[model samples]
Target: MAQNTDGGNPFAEPGELDNPFQDPAVIQHRPSPQYATLDVYNPFETREPPSAYEPPAPAPLPPPSAPSQSSRKLSPTEPKNYGSYSSQASAAAATAELLKKQEELNRKAEELDRRERELQHAALGGKATRQNNWPPLPSFCPVQPCFFQDISMEIPQEFQKTVSTMYYLWMCSTLALLLNFLACLASFCVETNNGTGFGLSILWIILFTPCSFVCWYRPMYKAFRSDSSFNFFVFFFIFFAQDVLFVLQAIGIPGWGFSGWISALVVLRTNTAVAVIMLLVALLFTGIAVLGIVMLKRIHSLYRRTGASFQKAQQEFAAGVFSNPAVRTAAANAATGAAENAFRAP
Candidate 1:
């Protein structure tokens, strides 16, 4: 190149000769090239050193091993296995419940069997062998019980309540009759004219008590027990007569054995205490009449349901009469005598 006009270092790098600040002194004062290194400022390392009393950190765990083919296959079916287990548990519970019901049915069947056996035993003369508990008499008494009455044992489940009601009605009638006797006695004490009533009251009690029991009550009992049409008819006839008697007794006609409403009113003027007693007796009689009517209707309804009729009663009566051993023996003797007489005449 031509001799430079400006004064400049001839041995300098090509671009440094144009820059005056690129001197060695300035370059030395300038920052050195910062090369990136592996070291870095860590915030966790800046924390205080671990205390000597603290437990040491656990070592890093090893990586998990690869799953085997069998385990991998079973993993996908885990939910299905759980579902099958729940279904089996429910099935077991249902089976247990069914077993419990079967046990209950078996227990009921056994109870029924026991009842049937007892009934069969009772039917085969067991009832006759049992001692009579009704008309409960003291052992020292000379008179023994005439009948054995056990509504629960003798009557069917359907007829038990009806029979019990009739029995209670009979007891009430007996008590009323006793009260009537007392009232009549009281009336006689207050007025001499009532002597006839007092006298007749005794006879009525003696006559009506046993007769009513035998004729109407016994027939009703037998009718319900044996389903006998003849007994039912007898009960109806006698009970109707009893109903009429109740009405007559409730009417309280003068000089009648009963201390009825009319008699009570008549005695009211004579003695108030006697009148009160008589009125009570009269009301009892009236109630008996009403109850009798109701009971009659109930019995008739039951009879209708039983399919009993006059023809059935007649048939039963005829059959009963013909079945008598005494009647059969008499008939045989008569026939034999007639045959002998005919042969002798020939």
Candidate 2:
């Protein structure tokens, strides 16, 4: 019995060899896949001291109790335990699936953000989201339809009088050129003491006349019709050119010569009265233009309500032109110059 005990174990107390079949009373235990041990304690347990205890005479061991069941070794028939391993593998697979879905969600969110930014940049309708903000344009325009269309294709408002004025100016310039040519013919046909005036008028026709067609009037037509920045710049340049030519004529009027400036003096020759008449016509044109701008203010509120640029709003209006009350009114007014009273016309 004494030899059967694990005497080397520090947790085994002395004199435990008598109960060789019983396990040692343990004080601590370790429950882990990597280790095996169990500990136990009993406060009520008492040990008899050697002096108080008497040794019992040894009884012959009953010929070992029938072979103990615990002595049998385990056989391969025992059920195999794969439950824990399979569960751990299933958990890992589920985590991988969850991560994949999370990544897919993140990618979709990024795509949405990209599209939103693009939409924000292209404020297609001259209308912006904010009251104070100018309509923001896309970096690049895809206006293929309007690329080569008529200059007046998309005007939201009318300036027919202004357009007509430009035409009249062009006609007058052409008539003046023809008159100068006839004057030359007349000087050659009849007896003129000094042909110098005819020659000077011819010079005026040559220098200042083509300008109305090629520079000033054409550019003005383009600017007003297109309402484009590039055309506006062209118009301004031509205006400055004409202004300079007129200024030089005003200064150099004394010398009657065939210079670009001298044709301007031809206006003075047409009679100071003709010059005054031209001035009044020009002033009337200016006043009508200013009045148009004032009217535009009332129209501006409608534009605010529409929240669209000229081209975009015009396209929409033309497509469903009269569906909106404001657009219907505008279209009617634009057809005739009398916008405020067009509906009341007899």
Full-model lDDT, candidate 1 = 0.84
TM-score of each: 0.66, 0.28
Cα lDDT tens digits for candidate 2, 226-249: 444344445555655554544443
TM-score of candidate 1 to 2 decimals: 0.66
Across residues 47-118, which tens digit of lDDT does each residue of candidate 1 receive? 455445656888999999998754666656455444567898998899999999998888667657656855
Error of 2 at 3 (Å): 99
For model 2, the superposed segments whose C-alpha errors exceed 4 Å read: 1-157, 180-193, 243-346
Error of 2 at 248 (Å): 6.5
Question: What are the RMSD figures for all models against the true structure?
Answer: 14.7, 26.3
